[model samples]
Target chain A: MVRLNNLQKEYKGFKLNVSLEIPEGCVTGLIGRNGAGKTTTIKSILGLVKPTAGEIEVFGKAPVELTAKEKQQIGVALSESGFCMIFTIEDVIKVLKASYEDFNEDEFRNKCTAQSLPFDKQIKDFSSGMKAKLRVLTAMSHKAKLLILDEPTAGLDVIARNDILALIRKYLEEDPTRSIIISSHISSDLEGLCDDIYMINDGKIILHEDTDRLLGNYGLIKVSSEEFETLDKKYIVASQKDRFSVTCLTSEKQFYIDNYPKTVIENAHIDDIIVLMLDTSKEG
Target chain B: MKIIINNTSMVPVYEQLMDQIKQEIIGGGLKEGDALPSVRNLAGELKISALTVKKAYDKLEEDGFTVTVHGKGSYVAATDIPLALEARRKAVEEEFSEAVSKARSAGLEDDEIREILEILLEDS
Candidate 1:
């Protein structure tokens, strides 16, 4: 399990003070818009950045002070993390094998085969998607207990994105003891995959809940002006006005379904809830 | 296989998947006992949800149009789906007739509507 107790990281412009727990045997998606400290939180967890205050622990050990053996148990792939530009894919495989004692060459080769990345091709010659695939292969090859990826699919095409997601699913299936933390803006990727979602905004965790609970607890209510006026304002979390007003993305979908018999209570998608909860309307 | 999906189509994704597969089978592109791609494989290919593909596959199996074998895969059951298919085809024909009449009332000639449909069909 990964735990961050009142973790605080201060920058000239950004200060991230996030507290959350990522349960094992599940995917925890860290979601937020750009500049919302998603990457910073990931960096802190990986020990690439020093938290000014609070505590951070992975598998019950401080990530920064982790021994090489302990470090080998964790796999990290940040968007900007890549091999030396001049190194060929084969060279990367060799380097990773040397770096981690538990590296699985066969798994690395299989991933390379699946992605169709030529092992002899230099890293600098690869497309963004190819590079991302290489990073994924390297990360997975280490037989790590925990996998942390930051925007690994940011610039990838649909095929490549699907391939990456498939690989993650396969990995999870292979090792039930393993856990993953994926930080991305793609809500669909997390919708079914994540056991829990942690939404961070402006360097703080605004909400954290199990994926099923979030979906079950919140809903989208579409109503005409007449029905809108009858809605209890206390239950309303957020509202948007179009030709009509939609109110309170609540968890109890059936409450509106039964109470407002004539009202339409559509399922609230993860993206809609996040966007509404963040309430960009309140922002400049 | 001759298949099509519309981004602007009001049809939900699961229904679209089921319809496309049915149309492909009826068009003689997907034969009986043919092994369809796994749920994950098809979802990856279609750029949609795995759950959505599973929903379509579940409906297909429940209707006896396909059979899923655990630890093996999903396959087209058999070509003995006439009655169920005829009902679906008739529904489509009824909807198409309404659409055509609506087009006629909106000032579209038969030849013009055909040309427009041909253009739309060509893209898929």
Candidate 2:
């Protein structure tokens, strides 16, 4: 549904050069720490920021070149922006109805009521969770075929985060062909939702893997310096040394499980990958 | 069939899913010709990617545990009962062998390990 070919964007110091493909009916996750160029990549896809070089295609056309109908097919809920805070829920609904031809006003209103968002109060008066829900509800109300959600669950409590994630799941379940690109620092959010994951760091695509393969194959092995010295480094992708032990990241987890019976091996979670894969040190 | 995923398990989600479905079929919870839930439905219910569910279903079909008819979803395969039972017995025997080896490593004599197994069998 979306494709980026060597998409590059440059600021004063940081440069983002990423190649990503979001196939139809797949939910792809973009994960990284703050200032890791996640937002830059998202902005480039939305055509909110002009790329310094390379190409981005949303629905087979440049995002900026998309027709009005094509634009309506893409739902966007940016992290730091939404409707005017002064507008009440009713006002926002009116704006949505005016903006999109397919917007379902009654369904949107019912969802807002179900979420316990008061219609009379301005959006600025709503809690963070309430505002977040409104943004997602608005995005889904138009029956968009693709959703570009940036931190939809950011800053929310666990319950709130689960609720938002459930909403996204419901949206996908409604249409099996729909696709989404969700960007978040929250690994758990992406872990359950995305089919594939892209790890970005220092304005570059560091790793891309299918979520299933990642959970199945990636592992972290902790070994003392002596054991580390004897350990085969063929499967080790990245490693770091602490004062007492060396932590190694390996993609061939089953190799170590079969050969190194005495070594401590743990499955690598997304958070572990973020830390270990993003580490600048090379495997020794 | 109820499918519970252990998020913290070292096993992959698709493998865990395949195991649960296999157990259901073997234990008679899922009988031959029973239609499995659609991949999208299971994925939504489990809050996992549909691709993962599809992978498990594909693997089950490949293993002759299930059969897929295009657009009709998956169904428990009409497996050979005696062969299935024999496979399960072999799996149990392997488990016992592993347990006995561990017991021997811990310095337990053959008689002690046999006694423990008898006692566990009586309780079961």
Q: Highest lDDT, which number?
A: 2
lDDT of 1 by residue, A1-284 (tens): 79999999999988999998877766788998999999999998999998999999988977888888888888888899778999997788788988999988887887798789987778898889898988877888888989999987887788888888888777776665678899999887776566678998889888787664555456788877777777865556677766656555766666666677777676677798887888743552
Cα RMSD of all models vs. native, in order, equals 8.4, 2.7
What fraction of native interface contacts does model 1 preserve?
0.00
i-RMS for every candidate (Å) is 6.6, 1.4
Model 2, docking class: medium
Q: TM-score (0 to 1) of chain B, per candidate?
A: 0.66, 0.83
Weakest lDDT window of 10 consecutive positions for candidate 2 chain A: A275-284
lDDT of 2 by residue, B13-122 (tens): 89999999998998899999999998767887897877889999999999899999997899999997569879889999999899999999999999999899899999
Q: Chain A of model 1, TM-score against the native?
A: 0.94
In model 2, the Cα lDDT at residue A165 comes to: 90
lDDT of 1: 0.79
Q: lDDT per residue, candidate 1, B24-109, as tens digits?
A: 77767788989888765565455554556677889988878889998567888885767767888899999999999999999999
